[model samples]
Target: MDQAIQGKIEEALKGLFTAVSMLQDAYPGKPFTPDGRLVGDIGEVVASLAYELTLNEGLTKHHDAVTDDGRNVQIKTTFGTSLTFPVHHVPDYYLGIRMNRDGSFEEIYNGPGHLIQAQLSGRKATKTGLHGGLMAMLKRINQQVPDSERIPKR
Candidate 1:
């Protein structure tokens, strides 16, 4: 990873968490977690920088960015465990990561979308993808992907 870009991410995450901590401290019982679109957006930004991808204009549905070689990629990030893949909308590539509170992250999955699609298919369709299925299979699935197939980090 680029130290400069990682530093920027750490700075931004620190500030955001500091604010969330203050809010949580105010309400002693409730927890204030940074999730949803914020995490998704952060993942997209980090993935774009790390993989040197070109982010698509607006919300382009299934894919978020185009790789250097022009393959469409769907980026996924989670502060917690598991990601909900849209079964109906698989892209050319899929990148999944987990973000920690300290602004660090782990690449959970990165490979062809078919890998994920196979894991999520033949299940009940709902507004959300991968309900009870495929949650525990990411690491196992990611392992099958050869490193050469992944986009090289910048």
Candidate 2:
């Protein structure tokens, strides 16, 4: 990562935190959290930089970015404890990350798309609320992936 670009991103993140704090102070107990599309956008930006992905145009089908080696990837990001991938299409690979407060992120899952999907199969969220698999579960699945199968960052 370029230091100049990284420094700018860090500054922008600080500004975002400031805004979130201000909203919380003003609203008092009302949740003015950034999630859904906004959080997704942030995830894309972070993925493109940290993982060196070439981001696709707005809302492309299946995958969001392509790797340097031409692998299609669906990037998932969450600020909360869990992430839910869309049921429609799983890309060639999956990269799941958790955004931290300090503008850094923790990679939760980086492995084949099918593997992650397999974990979600036939489990009704309401049965035990499996609708959204938790991060801890994802982490365990991630361990099953071999390093050679993971997308390598340059």
Score every model by TM-score: 0.87, 0.88
> For candidate 1, what is the TM-score?
0.87
Could you tell me the lDDT of residue 69 within candidate 2?
78
Q: Scored by Cα lDDT, where does model 1 land?
A: 0.81
Candidate with the greatest TM-score versus the true structure:
2
Task: List the lowest-lDDT window of 10 residues for candidate 2.
Answer: 122-131
Candidate 2's residue-wise lDDT over 76-102, tens digit each? 888888887656556699898998866
Weakest 10 consecutive residues, lDDT, candidate 1?
Answer: 127-136
| Per-residue lDDT of candidate 1, residues 4-77 (tens digit) | 87899899898998998899989979778777899999998888777868899878878899888888898888
TM-score of 2: 0.88
